[model samples]
Target: MFSSSVHYWLEFYVGAYHALKRGYSNMDVLVALGTNAAYFYSVYIIVKALTSDTFEGQDLFETSSMLVSFILLGKYLEVVAKGKTSDALSKLTELAPETAVLLTLEKDGSVISEVEISTQLLQRNDFIKIVPGEKVPVDGVVIKGQSHVNESMITGEARPIAKKPGDKVIGGTVNDNGFIIVKATHVGSETALSQIVQLVEAAQLARAPVQRLADKISRFFVPTVVVAAFLTWLGWFIPGQLHLYPQQWIPKAMDSFELALQFGISVLVVACPCALGLATPTAVMVATGKGASLGVLIKGGNALEKAHKIKTIIFDKTGTLTKGKPSVVQTKTFSKIPLLELCDLTASAEANSEHPLSKAIVEYTKKLREQYGSPSDHMMDSKDFEVHPGAGVSANVEGKLVLVGNKRLMQEFEAPMSSEVEEYMSEMEDLARTCVLVAIDRVICGALAVSDPLKPEAGRVISHLSSMGITSIMVTGDNWATAKSIAKQVGISTVFAEIDPVGKAEKTQGLAVAMVGDGVNDSPALAAADVGMAIGAGTDVAIEAADIVLMKSSLVDVITAIDLSRKTLAKIRLNYVWALGYNVLGMPIAAGVLFPFTGIRLPPWLAGACMAASSVSVVCSSLLLQLYKKPLHVEDVPIPAGPGDGGSNLV
Candidate 1:
């Protein structure tokens, strides 16, 4: 019978024994002490009844059962709440299509046949076709046709983007119109969609810096509560026996040693370290999951915790604040060649080049060809093509030497430039435009002005940062005039121009800098900054180096990320305040501080309820972050504004 009885309470027995064996005490040690004291006293009462037959007192079997039951219930509820915090990550895994439609084209470029296959069978260089109202199955570049794809899943951009033959498409976006034939560039896990899901999962599992303090406090809290409970027993029972208190002041029930024991047990049951331990981890989990749903990929908790404290946000001018692709805005001619003919010639020379400016010229020429009929019967391909690094391309079109590039390319061919052409190029540079010189047989024909324009939301994003008191700074390798011109358009006052890759990193030193960039050269600066944010549509090097990645590649997402961080941190602070407040107020009352005055005391069961409620309150408070919405306007209560009645920058 004794062996069977010990088996039912085996966990408590083993826990108490282990605490003594290890010569250390934790929350388990305190729990063992409380339950063992009640259980052993009950056994002694039963022993007296069995031997002497004079025991009429009660055994505290219910006390041990109630303590274990409520604490176990609290732990079970905590695990359930923690699972809900990571729901966003698990939902992302269900987005990709399971199957794809493979396509085989005839030699004449007509569709020969189509086959349905699993997405796992897709490989690089394979062709696939996506119809209207179907999700894309893999990451690839469009080779035929155009469509508007909804990329809300990959990037949080709600608007559908127009995709042409040369545009790249993600794996999970929905195609709205037109049949698109794509040549698979990335398949399976190597796709950008998979990378995003992996990042979200990793971030949710990581620990935040704020959790360190909570963890350190919990290490000492359990043992301290155990000592406090012992002192509470000594304060109440020792005074009652020694006649230290007046007869009128002390309650008749408190005069018994059983009353002192009940008070000590209440203190042990009420002081919960579970709530304190959960204060930071639960908040971080919800914030990271919430960030993933908004297309802001915080790489880990450390980055999310650091984001709210940014004082200066440094922006890379190229792909971050402005469209990285250059577009042909204007073209000037120096000869009798028609404007269309000159454009066709320049486009032909740059057709084989892979530079962004070259692709821009090619795209412009194609758009013009669709609008107006071409002058030539057939477009001849350029031969003997050669690209001079940073200068331009030299090729032969229609057996004539065609040189299309910068001024340095023209100068190498001894192409004489008149003051009229020089003045035109200088004016283009002042407007933040790049001029590409076109020459035929050592003679300068004209210059095509290409400009990488600012994104439409750049001004509003900068204004939002200004309102938040975060200084906006532009860093770029462009010339001073061009950099300042773009910065002025984006509402930025600080400009760091004409700097090399290393110089950009050097500029972020000794400040709480959040560097926003999207290129290979930006990797160093992204790693060196306090918080590095990469554009999702940027290079792999930049994304890997950054701490956070904005998948939408919009400047507006930067504002969203910062606001989310501030709100998340605010939630963490609120949790800490509530948890500490609960312990500070409940511990004293449970220790019988008010029993001497009003004779008000908490029973063990009531203390159990309060302990369980404290943990649930902390979890529920963190769950509120799931409802957080990004403040779109100045009047929407910016998180950096802190909690107050009124403030400026509100409209």
Candidate 2:
């Protein structure tokens, strides 16, 4: 289980030891003596191979040494850089629950007691007693009592959430005081804490893919250097110089060729793409680090690549585009269809529904019932109900045919809408209120306006994108007018309204969409887009589907994300300039370009040493990423509420 660089360095050093043991006499001065012999032999071979055909330079000894040294140096630097970038993920994952308060079954009335157990054994529905200042062992619903829990490790929020019976608690969150019993709902890998660890692991494994232009240029450049080095040796082999060898001209030509070969080998040793190989990942590591500090999660290299191209954005109506706080505005009592009866019908149909819209309707009905006294006596059965997916519902309620849906449901029954009602509906609908048209028997009763507020920073985030020359758009399951109104308010001009999951993906196609959302419904859209950004805190599905997951879950991270991409791209370009510039100067020198005038050719040892310097320079350039601090401007959207909005519940 050694990290890549460890294996790279270990093999290099171990091979160096073996190479010296076989070639040199002294085992005690293994490293230094081997290095000298390798260099001297390389110089002999390079010059000899260059000056004469009767070449006598031993091939393997010097060549193997040079190749290993440069590679080991490159690898050592990489390991250190990766450790720095890995800090955020490592620190977050360390917050896992260490132990749990285990409960064992007893015969008489299930005697309750606690024992310590491994965190892995915690499961859904298992009741665990939590005390103040202890970390909650797993994600669960509180079964008894209440307490405030600090959840900064998972959500990146400093504020603590007050948890009561049925309130969800995440594993690793500290229970700040008060005894409470928690019924585990999600455990182990299903927990939010575990998911964050998994996502980070997956992102690390992904190949930091190369830019096409850079890859092509490097591919040809490496071989060209190889070819040029060969030609430098040929100049020495062509014969006709002041005694290149000792004694005879024939043997002298061979010695001259050997000297040329040494210099040529030095060129090869110096020519490693060590710095070039690191250009992208170094910048990427810094970019992701910048994002992490701002509570933004750039999942991988591809996310860093595609975020610059987004033009149009999409959203889901009930949750993503709205505040997710749908409330009742208007309700009418029909003599035929009573207000209480309508409430009963809608509430019963939505009893098992978890959608935010459905929850709002049910809660609104309960509040009305609590205010206006008991409902009229009417027979109702929980068994005789069915939920319609897109539109509203049709159910047999006390043998009476009741149909409650959107405007389309009224249109299907041919119920005429009055101008006064129509005008009220039209005005509210224009403002992005979801108007549900209700009906009982053959008559249109009245309309209900349930409005979900716009997210606070939605408008500002879109405006920022436009300034960056990136166009912003939204796709949502909301009605056309509702979607249009939200788009207008958010500074988004284009939107695909009334789109389901499949439609969301199709809309994502054509435009280089960066879908930003934080709910399960947005999962498909996240997978479909050129890049998906899951914004919001601790959303499991959003974390999974998106290329980038927002740790803070704010709309402002959208701007930060794009900004990081631009910055990282610039860094990579700078690294390329340096790598290419170094080679441009060094390559010709290795080719005997200065031969006749200077009368001094580079020895193999000196050339290899110079090559190592270039690679080290590249390594130093990559380390500059540590200085890239995330921008200081972080934005937060205040949660909205109005006169009629429900009071915040403890959770």
| Index of the highest-lDDT prediction | 1
TM-score for each predicted model, relative to the true structure: 0.88, 0.78
lDDT of 1 by residue, 1-651 (tens): 667545645765686578668765555666677777677767876786688754455666788777777766666666766677555555565677899999888877688889999999999988998999998988999999999999887776778999998899998889998788998999988887788778877887799988888867766787898889999888877986887776665444233465677788888878866677677777877887788777889988899989999999999988787768667877899888787777788888887877888888888887777778654333567899999975789999988888998778888888888898899888877776777889988888888877776666777788988999899998888766677777776778999887878999998786689999999888999999999999988999999999999887877788888899999889888888877787788889998888777878986667777777777788889889989887763233233221111110000
Specify the poorest-scoring 10-residue window by lDDT in model 2: 642-651
**Candidate 1 segments whose C-alpha is farther than 4 A from its true place:** 1-29, 243-255, 369-372, 375-384, 396-401, 411-414, 633-651
lDDT of 2 by residue, 38-122 (tens): 5566566678689998655455464445555655555667666677667766776667667888765455526367788888877
Local error of candidate 2 at 444, Å? 4.6
